[model samples]
Target: MKATNEIKPRLDVVSRAITSIVEGVCKENDFDIQYSGIESTDGLPVRQLPAIWDALKTAKARMNHQMNQLISRITHRWNLASSIHRLPAEVLAIIFQEFEPIPGHPDGDSSLLNLLLVLRAWYDAITGSPQLWRSFGAHTPYNIARLVVDHSKALPISVDWRPPREPPKRDLGKVLDLAIENSARVKSLTASVPHEGDPHL
Candidate 1:
């Protein structure tokens, strides 16, 4: 019927528009099409897509065996390209860097380190990146101390002691000692004493 023909094309357009909007939302949310196996980027259960299933049903009814074969080939290619290991080291590192560790995101440092354990390639690239190491201050008795030791000779040193809810765990005297220790080499020195009641130090 002519009426059915016009409605079918309009329905197809609506389905495609919905698909495009869902894809955009996923990308903005930092999720990929391959994030979960069955679902598409829009969180749609692939099985429930009436348009896609209808097309397959139509092909089957028409005895279009080649359509199934084509679908299999496309699925294979998609799986290979979407593998996390297929990503370049530089690209992965950049993605990891997006979750920067700061007061706002205290657990970011540990999370990035955990991500490094996923595979040898991620571990090597993350550990080897200097930009990743720069955020962890040398004052913290962590491995970043080496970077501070090496760069302290020329770089300006700024230390901010932000204690948790309790009183200052690190003594003010110790911070003053560090300032004096690098007084000759540091171009600028900044030290923050957390007020007894202030949340923003």
Candidate 2:
């Protein structure tokens, strides 16, 4: 993802520059053909036709950038046709839940999320699985957190905000809102309060 984020903009810049040059060359070629009044290459000055042909060939080669796109499309199709897609949706959902750690656990395996990302074809199965969305963490934004809670299908959930930096100096009001709102369904709760300077415990 880091490489992708960096390389994509550079590729876009190069593609745009090449497209501009190609358009300019095309305009020049069209006007020259009209101005020459030659019905065919046979009537053109000696050697000029060969030079034009060479330039056209060079332009075509410069446009070989499309070859990368062709390869990408081929790989994309290959991934889409992978045998893993043949698994039933229920099986996929179960497998994802097996690999995914309890939501909002202190030592959850973050890398498992990366594994799920690689299996792009199984997005529906993963998101549709209620077991995978049963955790709430302070790091999740409010909007997405709401959706995650909603996706849990009213199952009792663990609420965790135990990271030291959470709640920004451990403001209890800010950190406990969601847990309070969903108190009925919150089965386990953990939080951290920075008590370094507080006179009151």
lDDT of each: 0.51, 0.63
Best by lDDT: 2
Residues 1-201 of candidate 2: C-alpha lDDT, one tens digit per residue: 487336555766766665555445545555233222224335445655565566667877866767778878888888878888878778987777766644563356544356556756677676677777777676554654575577778788888766533333344444468667888988887777747874433
User: Which residue pairs clash in candidate 1?
Assistant: none
Model 1: residues with Cα > 4 Å off, grouped in runs: 1-82, 103-109, 137-159, 166-191, 196-201
Model 2 off-target regions past 4 Å? Answer: 1-69, 101-106, 139-144, 163-175, 191-201
RMSD of 1: 16.9
In the range 84-112, model 1's lDDT, one tens digit per residue, is: 76888888879877653432123325466
RMSD of each: 16.9, 10.7
Model 2 lDDT, full chain set = 0.63
